[model samples]
Target: MTTESIDTAAEIEAIHAVVAAVQKAQRAEDADAFLALFHPDAIWTTGGGKFLNGRDEISEFTRAVLPGATKDGYATYEPFFVRFIRPDVAAVKVRQQYFNHADELQSQGSPLYGMTKEDGRWLLTFCQNTPVVDH
Candidate 1:
């Protein structure tokens, strides 16, 4: 692999890890853990269309809404695509699956995460969650 390819591989892996962390945090309903993945100036939009500007806003919304969210169901996030808009910036599309305690599929989400590598760490800079309606 060329130098560029090698760097790309490592970046992709790092981005995937961030997505996995999101899943883990959400599954456990740990707001602090989930908020830690975002940049201090990050912007986020929930699947329901609420816009959260900045990490502080996101943190407030998350803390108020996330704690009991998974009481009935847990979600998993899997990166389906990672596109490098720049060496330090990545646009990641993730497939989110929610399953109930009974192990039945509950809902699905298509979340796009814009991550920027700062200080050698990938942080969620911009994100939008769109719920998928299964007909």
Candidate 2:
């Protein structure tokens, strides 16, 4: 493979790692771990339409919700597509699914995560979680 291909592959892997970290953190209810994957100025919008600006606001919101989020079911975040807007920036499309202990689907969401590479690490800069509603 060419050097460019190699670099692209590595970058994709790194991005996937960040996505996996999100799932891991949420599943484990590790707020610190979840927050660490975001940039200090990150913004997050919930599926319910609440907007959280910056890491502090995101932290507060996550702390309040995440702890109990998995009490009934655990969520899995799977990145199905990633588009690179720049070498250091990517738009990731993730499928979020929550399953109960019985392995039944409880809820589903589509989240768009805008990730940026800062200090050689991929961090989520912006994220919007939208619930999959059936009409």
The models' CA-based lDDT, in order, is: 0.90, 0.91
Point out where model 1 deviates above 4 Å. 1-6
How many clashing residue pairs, candidate 1?
0
lDDT of 1 by residue, 11-69 (tens): 88898889989988988889999999999999999999999999999999999999799
How well is each residue in 38-97 modelled by candidate 2, as lDDT tens digits?
A: 999999999999999999999999999888777788989899998888888889999999
TM-score computed on alpha carbons, candidate 2: 0.93
Clashes of 2: 0
